[model samples]
Target: MSGATSTGDVLTINGTGLFVDDRGPKDAPTLLFVHGGPGQGSYDFMHAQGDRLAERLRVVGVDQRGVLRSDPLPSGAPLNVQVLLEDFEALRQALDVDSWTILGHSAGGGYAIRYAHQHPASVRAAIYDCPCWDSDGTDRYRLPIAADLLERYGELEAARRCRELAAKPERLDPDDQSWGAMRALGKRYNELFFHQPDNTDALDRIGSQSGLTEDQWRRGVSHLPLLTEMYESKQHLLPELSQPSLLVHGRHDLVVPPDDVQAFRDSVPNGRVHTFERSGHFAYIEEPDEYAAVVTDFVVSAHR
Candidate 1:
C-alpha cells in the first residue's frame, strides 16, 4: 500500500498478494469492480474509468484471484466461485468498508452476480456491463451477430460459416465460429468487438500503458479450462437479483447480443437498462464521460 488512499496496491491476503487500484475518498460510497475474462486484470478498467468513477464513488477494481496482478493459483489450490467470492470478502474486511456497490463487466458479470447472491448484506447494488451471464448462451447467440458483422465487412465465406455455427446448440467459444471468421478478418478481427475501430485503438492504448508484465497479464489463462461444471450449473441460481440493478449495453456489442441484455433487464425486479448507441463492448472507453455519468448517477442513488 502506498498511502492512506493509495490508488495502486498489492496487498497480501490469505497468503496471496492481490492487485487493487483503489481510488476516491474513503467516505464516498464505494463501488467495487469485478472484471470479466475470469482472468483479465482490472488494469484496463482502473486505467479507463477508475479516475472518473473515483471522482464520485470510492472505486475499487481488483484483478480477480489468480488473475492479472494477483498471485497465480498454487498447485492443488482451487478456483471455484465460492473461493472467488471469499477473496472479495477478504478485501472488504481489509479495506474496512462495510458494503459497496459492484460493477461486473462481461464474464465478470457472472462473478459479480454470484458475489451479490452469496453476500447480499455486503453488496448495495449490482451493475452488469455487457455481462456474459451464460457462457454457452452468449457464445451461441453471438455467432449470428458475428455472421452479420462478417458479412457486412465483405467476408462472405466466413459470414456463411458463422451462420452455420450459430444454428448449432453447442458453439461455446470463439474457436467455434467467430474465431474462424475473425481469423479471416485478420487484424480487423478486433472490429467485431468495437462500434468504432478508433475507440478500439484508444482501449488498446490504455492497455499498452497498463505496465503489467506479459507473464502477469497472461496468468489468468489458467482459469479458462478449469473444471467449474459444478458451479457453472449453479451460476444462474439467482436469476432475479433482488438488489437495485443497472444493465448497460452497447448496441453494437456482438459478444453479448441484444436479446440477452433485454432478458437480463426483464429478470431484474428493480432494474434499468442503458444502451450506448455508439459503443460496442467497452463503452467506458468508447464513451467515457457518458458512461461515467450514467454509472455515477445510478450508483449514487442506489447507494442511498
Candidate 2:
C-alpha cells in the first residue's frame, strides 16, 4: 500500500467520478479519509493535515460522490446509506488496496461506520472525528449549547436568533436559505470549540485557502434527500457495529455534542472515546498537532 507522490486525478467508480488527493509513502499503512458534509469535498483535509499525517502513513482524502470535483448525481438520484456504502466499496476495489483504516469527519463519520459494519474485513479500524452519528441527538443538543455560548460572548441578539431558528425543523431544502442563515449565525459559536477564542482564525484561513468553490458548496447542500434518508434509516445500526473504533470529540461541540459520542461508545464494544477538553466540533483544526498524534497513535497501536 504505497501512496502517490501527487494528488491523483479523478477516478470513476459505480458510474460516478470522484477526486482523490493522495500523499505519504506508498508502502505505509493506508488511511482513507471520508470528509464531512453531505457535500463537502476532501480539499480541506488535504490542505490542513494530509502532509502531516503522510509522514507516518499513506493518506488518501476522497471527495465522496456528488461532492466537489466529484461527478454530481442527477437532480433526484436515488441515494441512501446502501448506495453510499456501495460507492465506498467500489472505490476500495478500484484503488486496489487490500484494506485501509478509515478516518471520517462529521457526517462522513456515519459513512465510515456503515462501511466498517458492512465490510468489516475490509477495514483495519475506524476513526471518527467529531462525528454526527444521530441527527436527533444533534438537533436536541446543539441549539441550547449554541445559545449558551452566544450569551456568554454577549451576542444576545444572535443567541435569540439561533434559539428562534432552532425551534423549527432543520431545513435541508437547498432553496430554503434559512439553513444557510442559521449556519452563518452558528459559525462563531462553532469557533468556540477551540480553547482559545482566537483559534477561530485558523478556520477562516483554511476556508479561504482550501479552494472550495461556491458551486461545490451548493452541490453538497443540495443532497438533502441523502441526509434525510441517513437520519431515518441509520440510527439503529450504530449499536450493532463491533469493529475497532476511536471516537474523538470536542467537549464544547454544539454541532455534534459529546453526548452523541458517548452513545456511540456505549454501542460499539470495541469503541473508545477521547475528548479534547479545550476543543469543540473541529478538533483536528483546533488542535492539529495533538489531533494528528492521537490519530497516528491509535492507528499504529490498533493495527499492531
Tens-digit lDDT track for model 2 on 3-60? 2224666777788777778788877888999887677777777777888899898888
Write down the TM-score for model 2.
0.83
lDDT of 1 by residue, 182-299 (tens): 4676666667678886775665677678666788877888676432431153234346577888889888886566667667656667888999989988888888899999999999
Which candidate ranks first by lDDT, i.e. highest? 1
Deviation (Å) of 273 in candidate 1: 1.0
RMSD each, Å: 3.1, 3.9
The true-versus-predicted C-alpha distance at residue 245 of model 2, in Å, is 1.0
| Candidate 2: stretches off by over 4 Å | 1-6, 149-181, 184-189, 192-195, 233-235
Q: Residue 162 in candidate 2 has what lDDT?
A: 56
Clashes of 1: 1
